[model samples]
Target chain A: MAEQVLLLDFWPDPSGVRIRVALREKGVEYEYREEDFQNKSPLLLKMNPVHEQTPVLIHKGKPVSESLIIVQYIDEVWPHKSPLLPTDPYEQANARFWADYIDKKVHYFGRSVWETTGEAQESAKKELIHCFRTLKGELGDKTYFGGDRFGLVDVWLIPFYGWFYTLETFAANFSIAEECPKLVTWAQRCMERESVSKSLPDQHKLYDYILEHETGQNQPHL
Target chain B: MAEQVLLLDFWPDPSGVRIRVALREKGVEYEYREEDFQNKSPLLLKMNPVHEQTPVLIHKGKPVSESLIIVQYIDEVWPHKSPLLPTDPYEQANARFWADYIDKKVHYFGRSVWETTGEAQESAKKELIHCFRTLKGELGDKTYFGGDRFGLVDVWLIPFYGWFYTLETFAANFSIAEECPKLVTWAQRCMERESVSKSLPDQHKLYDYILEHETGQNQPHL
Candidate 1:
């Protein structure tokens, strides 16, 4: 039986990138369908009727929504491949906690930097910095957010580094390198991975893409 | 060495009940410290400085915050006991997807029926009904959300059923039994477990507690 894997994703999407990198890490080949939010594919809407958002992994007809959940799914199904989560229960808990922090705090707030301006953007920048500061504190002296392994936390975060150029291009004083030097170093280390380097879209291209379309907000219609 | 486990929780907290039930299901003996949220314990403050919320599970000296996460942690650490999650990877993904739905959609919107009023309350009630309807669609005729086993979705949601009385007391016409009758039946099935029945605070007590404290809103204080 052939494995049928398809990822409904949007380019330069942090959540989508997380799934892409996870699949790459596991060496799982899948069809990548980039979603145009204006004209979303029928399959995507059918697969994820709840959110109707991208980064939906359709594995053998069963659709798994939520990017972090998808990453864990990819890892669990391909357990014999590159293991993303730690085997020890305590370490697994820690991995989940950090990955969740990145999702709930960092990624959620990070996008605001490019979407809004003046006070709103400033507040978002401060919050992103605070979030990164906390992450940096937790990630101190470790090669990856998963300690010695490029695991879940690394998967959730490193892709966001793809937006570093776009973030800097938007704000004059904002610099990820200056704010989180260790994280930047870690990002550099992650980029060395074939899975990560290949999966992430070029940062400059992302900057142009966001600027050209102003499709950055990507907030679902309420 | 005897295991040192403690739960920092508040009475009438649905999230806290989840951990309590999981612990009971595993027959794990541990201390339960009911927090005075007005003056939160210094240990709770130190343990979960990020959110400073309840349902923080302290195992040895380490703390695991977030109810669903804690439940999974408990299951992983004590795998031989009554498992809350499925062993099959695909089933685990489905479990996680629904559990996350319960957390993100059901639990997030369920409390709005009481804390809010006017059009906001009406919309919340509508959304809650819609969320339950979606869950019901997924659940169908299953004995539990895990099909037969009392699993992740059951553990995450049954606690909220304890608050069904509170919701009913708040709104004359609000009846979960009317909107989600099958869920009520599932709740009754869940209550048959000593782990569930013993761990949940009395429904009437929960109603009185919510009335007294009016602490229906536990949103993170920023």
Candidate 2:
């Protein structure tokens, strides 16, 4: 039997980075197939017929779509090394709560910032800062969102920091690190892990990519 | 040791209904404290300081917020009598995917229908119909969303049928069962199950409540 894991991914996409980080954390060897959003791959379409979205993970012969769900599946199937979730149900639920919170709050804040102009952008920035501050407050001396150990929530949130920082720099209005000092520190701490460090693209590179693609578009100023 | 399960709930909320159904299905006797959203309970606030939302489950004193997470925890703790999720990893992932999708799509569509006006309402109705139709398509031949068993997804979605019927009657523009026959049948099938049926409020009563509330408010119709 062949050991296979295929990730349909695109660089700088936080959702794709989630699966990539999970794979690296688990030390799982897998094939990487970067997808073109304009021209999606046949396998990507076939595997994820419902969404036709990227970050589809094909493990062995089975395909799992949705970044968060894929991450959970990976953790379950490969539980020996670097468990994404905690052992206790309460702890696991806590981890999932933050993960879901991040999905609900911060995830869309970034998009709203990117897609809007003027007051909307300002509003999005405010929302982002508020979320970061809340996250920092939630951290409150914990080493990781998972508490004392880097886990799913840590990995899920860390990827977005790169883009967020870039957005702050280019926009030249908001300062995330200055506002939410602890969360910035947390992001840095998360990046210190080899899996996260290796999986993330350079902040400058991501910044340049976003600038190049986003110019002339009525995009939200993040 | 006392086996105490504390549930902070609102009688009319669908999210609260998800946990209630799970509790009933698992045959777990829980102490329910109703929350007036206008004036939330202290326990709800303390338990879920971040979201400060209702349907926070305090199991043996440990708080588990987020209805889906609470349901999953309930299933794990009491796995014998009723299995809310499948034991298989892939199947469980699929169940979670649908549950998450319903949370985003179905719930949001319902909210959009309730909270908007004119063109916005029409757009929201279109979105709602699209989601319901998609769900109906997905349910094609499955006896329930989980297939052969009334599982987590069903529990999460069944409450919305009450709201759906209420919306249909108020708007007088759509029939969910007529538009999405499969989904309508699915709702009926779900209600027939004692666990789910017992947990839901009567359609006419909920509709009357909604009518009374709408009449009391000078809100613009959307």
Candidate 3:
């Protein structure tokens, strides 16, 4: 039987990109079903009834929700090439920990920078810079977050690099490169991969979407 | 060289209990250090600089933070016995999804039940019941969350059972056992295990601690 792998995804989602990058790395041929956030597909809702959110990976009709989990699933099921996680348990745990850190810390602060304005945006920028600095410290001159290899953290966070342009331009707080030069270096390093570069939407396009929503323009594209 | 595994934990923490249970399941003997939340030990801070949270497991001077991550690490490093996670990638993802659900949904609702008051408390109760119903529906007639053998979900959730008494008695909103009999039965089965029973602190004592804190009584223990 031919392997049927389907991804219910949204373009702007960093979470969705994690799975996309993983699938690409694994060279898995799968169908992509775009989800309309305004009117989420019934298939997506049914596939992920608990969250009713997208970036759901359906393998052989069995759905796996949560992007990081989906990425791990893909890596495990198709363990031939471009491994997302380290083989050693300790290293795997470290990678999982950082991916979660990105989810909990980076994802929220990154959103707050765009969603809020004035003092709140400034605070968000400070928090974001601090988080990036911490991430940079962890990266510490390494080629990627998992060191040398473009693995879990690279896949999880590289998508957010597209938002940096908008975040710096829109918020006018600080340049990501200035605040966390090493992290920006890491992001650029990740972009060298065809998988990382192709999986993410264009940065300017994402910026325009953010600008439209911020200015109360009708986001027909969004 | 002799092996060294140290756990920095606080009693009454469901997350901490997860590591303890996993450790016991593996039958690995190690030193346990209780962290004072008000004044966390220097060792705890140094070990888990990223999170500065406990249930940090130090194996031969290397630290693993985050409760669930630590739990998985324990399972991986000690793969010979009492495997906590399923070997299959799909099942592993399923277990991870539910654990994340418990963290995002159950963790919040479970805390809000006792932490808030009046209308907020009422809303929390409603949400908590809804979460349990979903969990119950997931559990159905399974002996354990992972079917016959206890697995990740059971380990992740059973710690919260100790809080059930405190939540029901103190909040006076609902009885967990009454709402989710199957879950309660599952919890009872888990408590029968020596690993689980030894890891969790007594329920009523935990309730009194909650009462004291809520009533503005001096919490020497806390």
Best by TM-score: 3
Give the per-residue lDDT of model 1 (tens digit) for A76-128.
Answer: 89988879999988888888888888878887677788888899998989999
Query: Model 3: DockQ against the native?
Result: 0.84
TM-score per prediction, in order, is 0.92, 0.89, 0.94
Candidate 3 lDDT, tens digit per residue, A1-222? 258999998887788888888988888888998987768788988899998887899999999998888888888899888878999988999998998899899888988888888999999999988888888887887888877778898888888898899888878747888777778777887888888888989999889877776446333222
Off by over 4 Å in 1: A212-222, B212-222
Please identify model 3 stretches exceeding 4 Å from their true place.
A214-222, B214-222
Clashes of each: 0, 5, 0
Please give the range of 10 consecutive residues that has the lowest summed lDDT in model 3 chain A: A213-222
Task: Calculate model 3's interface RMSD in Å.
Answer: 0.8
Task: Give lDDT: candidate 3, residue A125.
Answer: 92
Chain B structural similarity (TM-score) per candidate: 0.91, 0.90, 0.93
Q: TM-score of the candidate numbered 1?
A: 0.92
Clashing pairs in 2: A114-A220, A115-A220, A116-A220, B116-B222, B117-B222
Put down candidate 2 lDDT per residue, B148-172, tens digits, no spaces.
8888788877899889777786555
Which candidate should be chosen as best, given DockQ against the real structure? 3
Docking class of 2: medium
Worst 10 residues of 1 chain A by lDDT: A213-222
